[model samples]
Target: MPKMIFVNLPVRDLAASTTLYLALGGTLNPQFSGEQSSSIMFSDAIGVMLLTHAHYGVFTKRPIGDARRDSQVLLALSVDSRDAVDATLARAVAAGGRADPNPAQDHGFMFSRSVEDPDGYVWEIMWMDPAAIAGTPETA
Candidate 1:
């Protein structure tokens, strides 16, 4: 199998963050999850490690930046269709997350929406037309 990707994010509350991820359609991988952290499986190749601030501090010397005040990273995930993108955002809002302050994006062949999880991490949910991507002119 190819290598998988794991996004480690620090959160204030592990249980609340875990609930938000579960509502986003992610499965909890108990093997790597515990009271201080949660391993959320978005797919076979993608996983998110939600760690409590204290637990997360063990891995870094710098202070944990407050995502609500500043942005460190924007985690984006590609979905199957425009409807799926909308559905995911809707689910996010219903699960105690907030919608993006920016307006919805519609770029002809692509559609996107953003949401902030309970911990203020931004997640970009997007869908793009395969044909449109394939038809793009190549540059040297």
Candidate 2:
């Protein structure tokens, strides 16, 4: 069986956060969700567990930092093409995400853009050409 990844994040408002994630193309998984936490399935292999701050605290003794002020993680997603990367970023912004301050990258072989979720979590969208891996000496 293939390994699956579940990213757990602390959220201030469960409903709002769930809405945002849904808008960003995640499907709700009620089997693993509740009033205190929500399971947002991005794909068959990728699931994001959004836990309310209070519920999140139950899992850790340390205090949670405000992601808006401090970034602890950057989640990245790979798409099939350069256009897909841009399109996904656009969907994020349209869903109320903040665009990454850094400009999009166009290395011929790879292209990428980033957007910050409403909770201030960064999500990078990228696409890499298989041919570029072989053609680019820098990659070699």
Candidate 3:
């Protein structure tokens, strides 16, 4: 089986966070969801577990950091094309996320933009030319 990643996040509003992730093209995985948490699957291998503050605390004794006020980690999602990156950012904004929390990055072979979720978690949407990734020049 392929390896998978499940990013666990503490959210203030479970419903709102779930909605935002769905808008960004994730599907709800009810098998792993409950009143205290929602499992959003971006792909078969990538998932996000949105947990309520109280539930999240069950796993850690440390205080929950206010994502809106402090930096923890920057999550990144790579899309198929530059247009897809823009589309994802647009969806995030429409779903109540703040767009471009950081400056947009554009290199000839890559492009990226960021969106801050309602809880202040930042997700970087990016696209990179396949040729660049493969260390080859693009032939036009």
Of the candidates shown, which would achieve the greatest TM-score relative to the real structure? 3
lDDT of 3 at 104: 97
After the best TM-score superposition of candidate 3, give how far the Cα of residue 131 lies from its true spot, in angstroms. 1.2
The residue-by-residue lDDT of candidate 3 on 12-44, one tens digit each, is: 999999989988889999999999999999999
> Candidate 1's residue-wise lDDT over 51-139, tens digit each?
98899999998999999889888788888899999898888888888987556789989999898988788888899998786775662
Model 3 TM: 0.94
Off by over 4 Å in 1: 136-140
In order, the Cα lDDT scores of the candidates are 0.88, 0.85, 0.93
Least well predicted 10-residue stretch by lDDT in candidate 2:
131-140
Leading candidate by lDDT: 3
**Can you write out model 2's per-residue Cα lDDT over 15-51, one digit (the tens) per residue?**
8788777866789999999999999998999999999
Candidate 3: list runs displaced more than 4 Å.
Answer: 137-140
Arranged by TM-score with the best first, the candidates are 3, 1, 2
TM-score of candidate 2 against the unseen true structure = 0.85
lDDT of the structure predicted as candidate 1 = 0.88
Enumerate residue pairs that collide in model 2: none
